[model samples]
Target: MENQKKVFIIYHSGYGHTKVQAEAVLSGANSVDGVDAELIDAKEAAGNLDRIDQADAIIFGSPTYMGTISAEFKSFMDASSSKWMEQSWKNKIAGGFTNSSSQSGDKTGTLQALSVFAAQHGMIWVGLDLPPGNNSSQGSEENLNRMGASLGAMAQSLADQGPEITPPDADQKTAHYYGARVAQAALRWAA
Candidate 1:
């Protein structure tokens, strides 16, 4: 019970594609030996701010639309006004993931926006430290952006047609990396 990692993932998926990536994150986090990762849909999260408050780290995910977090995720952030006022999310580790339609889709933009939001909330940010793009053999899909495009869990799903075309690999890797990174950060923070 002591020193177990506590991780929470809050996400919003419009067409259930992003949900695939979100679930992948949960899988990776749960695979970690000492981590407890939970997935909270934005709709469900709105009613249970405690879920966010109780974690050592929080990971946010969404389907990037118009180059940022979805309207649903924005609504969730807005609803967190109460927590923001109370500083409920402060001092915790934070991370993010997204799914869109292109290789350079608005997914990363969404992650950046979320990162800024976490900082504004007085939280620490954990980005993927894995080396993705440097290795030529790893290529695009095997690199962090290849097989694991998610050190921060930002993925792109093409079905939504945002330009992050054919992002299933990106989504899987993104989810995996985000989950592991969150768990790793939470464990350290909890220590």
Candidate 2:
């Protein structure tokens, strides 16, 4: 539709685990009726910055490495300095997602970095609205928002497992829900 809002998911996945999460986020965003969602590999984003500029919302995804975003994704952030200088992304809806092998692999630090990156671009940050899950005595890894992240979606995968077998259904579902929320927010913000 002409009025459809665009959402770009820019991510860097080293071993495909984070790519799975990004795909889940894409699925959720595309599920919204008036949204057009697409994935942009962070490695290739520097050449497609204009496409990103046209987006109504942008969701960033990366694997948490050494307690923060991977160097490659950081490169994409640096490449956007031109946009930051021009405030081209100001007021655009923004959200983030990250994955790590350990459950508490300091993923919050990565989300904080993403948020800060968005802030530097003068973008509006959108956080996970779901209540913390798997925090109760009866809670299990099967709960959505299992990592209890509020800044963004978080997923954990076993170091030895592949994306097809790890990160679990709950994390994917949480990423999906987060994607939809961002899309909905974009629609409302544009309206």
Candidate 3:
């Protein structure tokens, strides 16, 4: 009987790269029918389990540093121990994203960390519907340059693009498409 799907994106951005991508992902998720999306700094999300408890689906994101989830995000994960113990997130939908300065910036490590946490919470995971390979420029647009974003919903932005630039149109579209897919899945399962 729920009328809407809520997606909570929890992310840690060390130098703003992941923050930008997280926003793009939110924009995408918000575009989906009957979906509401919001982004929370890792610290806040970790501290306020009530907000997290309200979400129908959760997306984790962070910049890959030393090939792993940033300490900020990891701290949030660690803080979720209470929810894990309570089985507060069991059966919820989960997804992840990351960014790095190198083309292969140990991004997968971040996703691995997230996946492990979700599994521990007994959550269901969602995969990127489109493959990174052979896209005919349906291409994730993340492929244009060489930065480390291959894991999860990875993306690249000029580290120095300043605040003037926004998530590129293609990337935003991809995010929206990803959002719609996940939203539909969340709705289906919730029903």
Best by TM-score: 2
Query: Across residues 1-191, which tens digit of lDDT does each residue of candidate 3 receive?
Result: 25898889899987776787787778878877788889899999988997799888998888888998888888999899999999999999988877666656667777888888899999998867665642464544454222323335665455556433644554545555565666677878886
Compute the lDDT of residue 177 as modeled in candidate 1: 63
Query: Judged by lDDT against the true structure, how good is candidate 1?
Result: 0.77
What ranking of all candidate models by TM-score puts the best one first?
Answer: 2, 1, 3
Identify the candidate with maximal lDDT: 2
lDDT of 1 by residue, 96-166 (tens): 88777776675677888898889888899988776565347636554555524443665656564533334
Q: List ranges where model 1 is wrong by over 4 Å.
A: 134-140, 147-151, 160-167
Better model by TM-score: candidate 1 vs candidate 2: 2
Off by over 4 Å in 2: none
Clashing pairs for model 3 are 102-147, 102-148, 103-147, 105-148
Looking at model 2, residue 104 earns an lDDT score of 94
Taking the tens digit of each residue's C-alpha lDDT, what string does model 2 give over 56-159? 99999999999999999999999999999989999999999999999899999999999999999999999999999999999998999989999999999999
Q: Give the runs in model 3 whose Cα sits over 4 Å from its true position.
A: 133-151, 158-169
TM-score of each: 0.86, 0.99, 0.85
In TM-score terms, candidate 3 sits at: 0.85
Q: How far is candidate 1 from the true structure (C-alpha RMSD, Å)?
A: 3.3
- What C-alpha lDDT do the candidate models reach, one value each? 0.77, 0.96, 0.75
lDDT of 2: 0.96
